[model samples]
Target: MEKLILTRLNVLGHPGRMAVFRLLMRRLPDAVPAGEIGQALAIKPSTLSVYLSALCGAGLIGQRREGTSILYSARAQAGGEIVDFLFNDCCRGRPETCAPVSRVFREGFPDMSDRKYNVLFICTGNSARSIFAETILRDQAGERFDVYSAGTRPYSQLDPFALEVLKAKGHDISGLRAKNVSEFCAPDAPQMDFVFTVCDQAANEECPAWEGQPVSAHWGMPDPVKAEGTDAQKSLAFQQAYGALRNRILSFTALPLDSLDRISLQKAVDDIARETPEVTT
Candidate 1:
């Protein structure tokens, strides 16, 4: 830990490297091409190459090859740790000293707090899985987001078990009806910031182009409505679906949206689908 701290300090010790890192932070969650970074800082390409290499070696920044260009972004985890370490140690007894740093990190990037993100969850029938996600997100962070669910092939109503499990968990089951996805495709419809397909069928279907080009990913899960068995067995399926959607929605709402650019946010949401769900019934 000490070694990493010293390495970060040494990398940022040079003025040129410091300039590069500060510029990268201002563009958090977006990777800047090497040429663009050099141009922005008015540094010669040859000299800038040395600084980029040093920062990358210290794990302060990361690079990825994008076609012919190498793009770099400030490594958020590493940068965050350094800030945490400094704040903890320097302000050990002086808590007030940390406020300015906290304020800067909170307000430094593009402000996304004032706006509520519109998120739509989609499934084939919207009777179960999609409804579960909508309710879960609404329970989780309804104030920060506008959550909705729909189906490609509409169901006349929501699945009974889906409502049963939600009501058991104390989620508001009101105003939840299965609707066709077309309703949200109108010109006057609310623009979505995120769209998720929670069933394989909906994921495979061709979707209408959204107004804002929302970040989308598949969060496919087994359709609990199709689980055929005794009453207890069928109810267990709804519980499992609820658990899975609850876990995913919790993770989604916890993201630091203000600090993440669209590209990073897209990858983050896609990665959530790969994580194992924790059953919480």
Candidate 2:
């Protein structure tokens, strides 16, 4: 029986099948059509069909016939099994190192139940650090709070290096765009809970006070795109920025907001802003 189970697992180890499975895992609940998967991965339809068939045969994916199209999604049980398999031997046999990250999803803000708490990151260009913070917060605190990012002066483009680093780390940034913060500070803007200036210039500049007099903080990061040197040196700058922001956001999300008073939470955010390490070469 053990041998038979190993044989079944081996079927999913194929590169093509693994790719299809990972894509489906990332897009749970949504049934991806066969053609879309092929296009996204640049796999030929005929080739993808073979891999999809293998996955279906192994019961790792579920297929639905929608009209003439066949849609596929990761089987929830199979997905769990895959995760277990991947991490079963991780941490060099230290079980504690494999614990899952925790998230908070509770009612009410730190003090005000009636007011919703929203976090907005502002920068001169919304292409790098601001965007990183926005996405990382969403990933870390998706259930408890709302997060957004924009620029005082919007850039015409996103830094390709930033996009590449995010993709390499398995974070999706599709449909994200650089927009001006003016859109949020307009008279009809949604009441912000916190406004974070993520660049030195934006932090120091005098701007219209946000609606509702939201608590403001400055979390400045050196502009990674401004790093000068070879291609590899510039790429390292983006990675350093990403790592620094990720660590700070991790610490911020771990705050015991539900138990802390408003004053405590404010102090905590300030300390977090002041103490996070500056990324460097």
Candidate 3:
């Protein structure tokens, strides 16, 4: 390990290699052609080879022949290791002082933008609240999140009122469906990145094993469909749920998700959910 670290240091010491390495790191997970890399950095053919060879030899970069062109990319795992090694010994116990390594690469790393977070919203019935949340997040953060909803005891269908409310608000409900939490608990299911239990009932329910042990939180909201009243009153109830959810959803999306560590992000999500603005219905 000592020798490997020394080798990494030696490869990084050269200014030319460092420049190439930095560019590749920024373009990580997406391989850039060798010719384009050298041209962009104004590196001569011969000089680029020396730089690429050194970084490759040190496990700092990887390359593959793509037709006539060679594609080179930073070894993301290797870069992560290098950074971890730098701080692991010191940040072991004092976690507060440790900067978020994900944030450090968030902007520079193209893969961060390309990456999608899988978010699951859950409730007891999956009829109203969970459906609302899944659609809201799916539409708003569709590019950033793959949103889904499920219930421990899922209803046979979506709540008609929930669909009506979203439709009136100009939200697309074509893909909205009530799914069983069991479907997502399967080992073959796509691992969720974040899971929000959207109602008090589901929050307390014994949920099946989740795929990724995703960061879980409860964002309880009252069941709008449960309100028994006049037609006008019933309409207003759904509207209030929509407004309250919209407010919280906006706040949740406003967060710098890529910048915040898990702990901070969890706190932010919980705080947003807890802020149940006084809704009138």
Candidate 4:
């Protein structure tokens, strides 16, 4: 243990090696490609190779071969030990001195490895508003949520406006289709954690009960595809809807889902629609 600590300290003593270690540490639990690391630090390939070898030799960093790309990440366990050592020894008997530092590291990145929650967004036609909401939530927190979209009256095809706006915002439009709400009411549908209606009509409609009676909310937004205007005006309307859904999705992600109960969560989800910033083109 002492030898490993000494080796880690020695490796960190160099400016270049320490920079590389810091970069890798930021993206812990997610191995970054070697090219990304090199590009980030702007270190020459030959020199970066030597530093990486030193850190890897000390067991403070690890490398994994992912197909053709070599990925690198900080050794989390070892890194935590080193951080503890610094906190314990530097503070001596003054625990309060390092308390803030400890909190920052522990709380800065909350646990995001919870089991994925299945969510469905609904609208009148499942074309513009619902589809945009679905894609935004999926793109924002795909790690924690499995998202789907449906409508009370399903459309024959996806709305071109929704597709254009989503693609423009770098969302994956592959396999996105306009589906009906009845598909989820069937016996074999995946249970949902949350359901949101993105249009007033869908939210007000009397629909069949969901399987889990999932926590439902109304996040009504304008139907961009229904806008009767010139091409430029229609484009702006879609952009506005996209922005509104993006804001609400971000608010949803910020909630403490684990800590809130059903009633509280329902209120919280409902409040998102009421409190989110207004949408504009």
Candidate 5:
């Protein structure tokens, strides 16, 4: 057996290959067709194939055949390694600088003192990533975080793939529905602690600023519903989105924020953002 080394994996070290890997990570467990990847990134199919091959060769991605099409997805266990590899060098050689942030999580959750930090995920359409993040985080974060999701302009219902992924993960979505962000911005809305935009359009759009001046973050994800393919192919997109959101939320909940001053807390949040894995739905 041969040992895997970073140098050997350097085939996946190119920016284009990394982009392809990020896309697969965002849509893990669901295989995306090469054509769609080419179209979305505007790379030539020949070029994209080379990058995809590099990922598959590195054991970071998997492939399956469906009739004439080949679908690709991130290998679940290997996916985490890729994520850690991207952030392993954080804080340089002096890791102790992160001690203040570490102490916060060591004290356990519910450390916020105030009611659990309220998080709202927003997108142009509430059908996909925003809704996925809402459900997954609520399940994983337990009672430590108050989670809500909405859209800048919502569709009439949840995306079926999104619903299916949540259900498969044992999250109850029986009463979940697409909602407009206006509902949260209304005069009677509950105060928010954080607001995240999960799509590029929503992140760039001008809207009424959050009333409480909630800390804002842009955690953009590719719109899984926009993925072109058969039902199963699109379903893969939802799964990938769920994986990426889960990874980001895990990092967020693991941060030590209880003891840090606002400045330090802000830096920790920035670190979380920088450390978040890039997903390509």
Candidate 6:
């Protein structure tokens, strides 16, 4: 166990490798292409190759080939084990001594079971990624949230793969369609407590001022609609998007909203985008 921990530590001890690992963690559950990572971190391809190799060798990250791109992501289980070791060693089985850290991990959201919160998801097309988020949240916590989604430039129809994947998962696909952002910005539209942009374009676009000053964050992901490959591969992109959105929506809904102040709540929501937790199969 100690050797395993030492291996991970040694791999992260280098500054460049640490940057690579941290970048991967920020984009968790999304397997980033190596070239994209290099551009984001301004690292040369040759040096970045060494860093990626070291991380993979230490079992700190995993890579898979998607089309022509080799994608990489942090290994959540490995990271969890290292954290567990360090925390356990610090507390020495006296759980009470680790109370502060425990609270942070718990994310202590206040229980607001009585009233429903409004959530809106936005994307450029609204045909795939944002639609997935809306459906998942509605299905997962419909009783607690009044969920909606819209696009900056709405598509005429829903993506077939988006509908197929959700229906396959036994989620009702009825009444789902692409809608414009203006629909939600009207005088009588439902007030939103939270708004999330699920695509880079939507996040960058100037948004109409929402009524209630909703807590907003960018939960951007690749547009599955643009994915090119076989029908099976294209469908796989939607499936992956569905999985990632479901995991994030579950985490968001699980929070105790009644317990947190606006500042804490805002930070918590923002953190969700940054720390994309490991998605289970």
List pairs with backbone clashes in candidate 3. none
Q: How far out, in Å, is residue 40 in model 5?
A: 18
Instruction: Give the TM-score of each candidate.
Output: 0.61, 0.58, 0.59, 0.59, 0.58, 0.61
lDDT of each: 0.81, 0.73, 0.74, 0.78, 0.72, 0.81
Candidate 1 clashing pairs, residues 3+ apart or interchain: none
State candidate 5's TM-score.
Answer: 0.58
Q: Give a tens-digit lDDT track for model 1, residues 45-139.
A: 99999999999999999999989999998876787778777877777724477876665443333355778889999999989999999888887
Q: Compute the lDDT of residue 42 as modeled in candidate 3.
A: 88
- In the predicted model 4, the residue pairs found to clash are none
User: What is the C-alpha lDDT profile of model 6 across 1-281, one tens digit per residue?
Assistant: 88989899889999999888876754544568888788877899999999999999999999999888899988867877776776788677455787655543434443347678889999999999989999999988898889999999999999998898988999898989999999998999998888888986665455687875676776887798999989988888888888888878877987778878765786677678777653333
lDDT of 4 by residue, 1-281 (tens): 66688789999999999888876654433466767677767888999999999999999899989899888877767877877777777776355788665554433322336668889998988888888888888878888899999999988998887788888888889979989898998888888878887775565455566764566776776688788889889898889988888888999999998776554676688678778885855
Superposed model 1: Cα runs more than 4 Å off: 1-111
Q: What TM-score, to 2 decimals, does candidate 3 have?
A: 0.59
Candidate 5 versus truth, CA RMSD in Å, comes to 11.5
Task: Give me the overall lDDT of model 6.
Answer: 0.81
> lDDT tens digits, residues 83-149, model 5?
3443344544233655544433222333468668898988989998998889878888858788899
TM-score attained by model 1? 0.61
Model 1 lDDT vs. the true structure? Answer: 0.81
Model 4: lDDT to the true structure: 0.78
On the 0 to 100 scale, the lDDT of residue 27 in model 2 is 47
| Regions of model 2 farther than 4 Å from truth | 1-116
RMSD in Å for model 3 = 19.6
lDDT assessment of candidate 3: 0.74
Cα RMSD to native, each candidate? 13.6, 18.7, 19.6, 18.0, 11.5, 9.9
